[model samples]
Target: MPGGRLTHRDRRDIGAGLAEGLGYAEIARRIGRPTSTISREVARNGGPGGYRADHAHLATRRRARRREAIPHRDPATPPDAYGRDPDAVRDFAEQLAALMVRTGVPRMAARVLARLITDDSGSLTAADLVQRLRVSPASVSLAVRYLEGLEVIRRVREPGHRRRRYVIDDDVWLRAWMTSAQQHAMWAETAQRGVDVLDPATPAGARLAHMSQFFATLSDDMSGGSGTVEDALTVLAALRHAGTSLPVAQVATALGWPPDRVTEALSRAGPDRLTPAQLGALQGRA
Candidate 1:
């Protein structure tokens, strides 16, 4: 009965409340839900910066369907309303899985990602994912490996577990963003080399030079707030390690670099591409 979750129809009113800049308590009173609930929904989804009931509702629905079809005995929520309905979560997961498949993600990888993204717990061991996904051990291993390389998911350690958990944190997008920009930067450098090789004054050289300039500039813009994309990359990275103090070594290792180099780079790189594995290796040397 947490008031935090809104119904579909209630989303419209939430929009009204938001437009008027009403406080959480006022919004909760208007919606007949708990203030904490509304507060959490906004905080978890996007803070005060960008929130839309419609989008949140849709995301909730998609999450629910991925878990299972809504059962007949489920309580009637206001059109977009959601309660602690187990079936709704299942339904959302089920639907999301289907959508991802249509978009060309392999079925197993899509299911694993869907579950990781939607779960309120926000962390799950590979065994948990495998059990929930109902895929083979090898499939889970492969999917998790691919996701880790893409920097779109992470491994979280839990006490009493022999194996680490796999999770999609709020920062998954940050890792992805930095990874991409670094990739583009590398491309730009390569293109510059192409220009030098082909003759700087020739048509081919000019084209390559432009390619290099375009990517290098694009990479720069990606880091700034006013840049084309809000560097969700840094914000997302910040969201992880929310409560705990991240060890300097841990941060460096997760980014793959020696401590001094990491220290230098954090000042300079500011969320650009860096390898996590190499950093971890360097930490062992420390």
Candidate 2:
């Protein structure tokens, strides 16, 4: 009953309902309509306090007339029915680039990525990017190089053509994620070297140790997926099983790994790797 357009009488009723201090849900129930319908009607017109029945009805009629005046396209029609809509593509590209920039992507890089991504062929040459983006060739070169370094895009050589086409593969995200993890691992190793060079008893060494621990955890979480944590815990669990005080070097030799690898596993294992029961068992045996 409430699906059709609201009548002047319904609008009057809605105004009256709002005047009666009724919430949108209660007003909707009284009018036999949905709460969202009541909410949208009030919001678009003016709001609860400012929504006048006559004004809202007149505004709704004007909107309806405006919408009716616009021509609707049939889905069966070709995309370029009246010729290519350059404005539509430009608006779409602008919005996509803005969205990328909001997600921490650099502005020019976002524009370049947006153009390449929205291309019909899903690939583009450096010249094509420069033309579409309206930027200099040098600018395109910088953006493409940055995107390539981040693994967000890759270059492909055509069979006959000489200019390499830049493309975003489906596995771009996976490759970028792995690259970030690899970088974190490299940083963590560097921090650990800092820890070794500085005396652990000093404040600077403690800070470096903490930094190393944080990066090691982050690296494992990114690259190790769930398996890395499980493997580290397994190593801790084995050590817990040994029930003997062993040097980290001795543990490394027994595990047939470099001392640093064993140390990394121990660092990643964290203090809470084992349950209280396991810890108590290890403690009692010790």
Local distance difference test scores for all models: 0.69, 0.78
Using lDDT as the measure, the top candidate is 2
- List the candidate 1 regions with Cα displacement exceeding 4 Å: 1-82, 94-105, 225-286
lDDT of 2 by residue, 178-209 (tens): 88888888888998899899976789989998
TM-score of each: 0.47, 0.48
**Residue 217 alpha-carbon offset, candidate 2, angstroms:** 0.8
lDDT of 1 by residue, 108-144 (tens): 6767787888887777888888766655799998887
Q: List the lowest-lDDT window of 10 residues for candidate 2.
A: 73-82
TM-score of 1: 0.47
